[model samples]
Target: MAKIPATIVTGFLGAGKTTLIRHMLSNAKGRRIALIINEFGDLGVDGDLLKGCGDATCTDDDIMELSNGCICCTVAEDFVPTMEKLLARDLPPDHIVIETSGLALPQPLVRAFNWPGLSTRVTVDGVVTVVDGKAVSEGRFAVDVAAVDRQRRADENLDHETPLSELFDDQIACADMIVVNKSDLMESEEADHLAAVLKADARRGVQVIRTAMGALPVEILLGQKIGAEADLGARHEVHHHHHHDDDGDHTHEDEHDHDHHHDHDDFESFVVTMGEIADPTAFAERVADTIRQHDILRLKGFAAVTGKPLRLTLQAVGPRIETYFDKPHAGPRETRLVVIGQAGLDRAAISAALTA
Candidate 1:
């Protein structure tokens, strides 16, 4: 029996995992693929986004959503079952992709692949680590960057015993391949410097590839064949993977924590249904400004712009916005915006900005 090939796409927040996945699906050369999306929202909007790609390979059910928590953490809960179902399909997919949460650690998720049922039937093609290049260049990833800029500004680390730098070190240490995304914003020299710094910090010989808008070769992503479970604890150059039974219930208040449920109001998402947007470029600019003014973390949707029959796509991260025509809207021109951020996200404030 030939085992199914699977690739684990793990990265921090806004690392462009979905963008890369979307590219692969659109140019898949007719290979059937299934995605197991561990969405941040209870409503599975990300799952719907992928399925709406208008590709035959992306079916509603084939686009599985594991919102309860990280699929790796709940492998026993649903991960195994989903894999079994995909395997049971009349024509099983050629490959499977698992998009881990931004704050997720690949080591733990990799461990789940070694389970008895999944081990023999499936193989980890590779662990593609997506990184935010502009952030790295701006010193967001390195605490040292913040330290040098504010020498007399009192080290924030003085108040906290442990620093986030340690966490980032572990993420880079465990990667098999590093996809330095969003390189379009950097100069060639800047990109090289970042790459050089990362390669040195990585676990010796980890491949570093620079990409723009998450664009990379499908050959590199599709089939390298690395087993995460078998190679879990050994690959980390700085630290080893921690294996705790974690029987006791514990709550963590961090980006990756999924134990708690978000109410419909924790974040609000809906479509501003109506005629096409008069000027999508201007509308997007205003929305971007609004996100910066407010506390908007993420927003994505499709809009129909006047004069353009195709559905103008809307994807924004923090204040940075990107737009383009995807395909014609199914019906009348309407705009749908999904806003995710801390509580107190004034929906009216955002809605007003769009219509104004």
Candidate 2:
């Protein structure tokens, strides 16, 4: 009974965890893999994204989804049983890749592996922390970290122990390896600066790899014997705890936190469907224009483009829309689009743009 290797990929919102996982699945050398997609949102959108990699090698039953809003709040309730079932399978996967929600914490989830019932057959290959390369270069994680310092004086009970910024630090601290994702989007100098910051701030001595959405050799991410279990003790020592709440109140746990709203950041969403959309480029531009007008967080769905041999898929994260030919539909299914955002969601405006 060989212990199965499990890899955990954790990152903030839009950091490209799904992209890297999809790439790995598509290019894997005939390894039977199982993917567990946990989304911050209530909808199973992230799971669908991984499935769109459109690879036949991955069995349909192998792909599983758990949409419990946020992993931080639901790890015990949702993750435990899920792991039990995965291990209980007679034909368990050779490898298991879990893409946790953007707002997820790696520590608690990793601790579950130590839980009583799961020790014999499973072991963490490693925990990989994914960071947004472009944003890391610009210093989004610590842009105003000291600002948090000053505000703490005003209120003593502030959850100064788990703020999202400090929470991100904890994720990096616990990583067996750090992947600076979206590396192609940054300049060499920018990448170097981010590397320096990461090396200096990392909880333990860890290696940082410059990768395009964590798209490195599968070998690097899998079978990493960083002795994550042994290092877990040291990692906990340097947690640098702060409040997870941005509002300075401990009331961060909310039901809709996973719903595209993400702390009232103003996300908007609308749905549009039709039989055909020939010009994907033109249609994508229209979607972008609509996003520019509103604070759109995510856009998804499939489209049947005319004059094309395959289905033109649509996916947008923030200002970026990644489109490509997935596979052709066997029967007639209209091009359905769902635009989601917290800032600028206008159904009429987006509908006109798509139909225009």
Give the root-mean-square deviation of each candidate in angstroms. Answer: 16.6, 16.2
Worst 10 residues of 1 by lDDT: 245-254
For candidate 2, give the lDDT. 0.64
Model 2, runs deviating above 4 Å: 72-76, 142-163, 203-205, 237-356
The TM-scores, one per candidate, come to 0.61, 0.60
What is candidate 1's lDDT per residue for 1-356, written digit by digit as tens? 98998888876655677777876777677788889876553346556667878888777766887666555457887888888888888888899998875545666667777888888988887788887788778878522344322321232212122233554566686687787877767898998799889978887546677777665646556765555567876655343322332111101111211223222232344554445678877888888888776656567778877777789888764566778887767865677777755446677777777667
**Alpha carbon RMSD to native, model 1:** 16.6
* CA lDDT of each prediction against the hidden true structure: 0.66, 0.64
Candidate 2 weakest lDDT stretch, 10 residues: 248-257
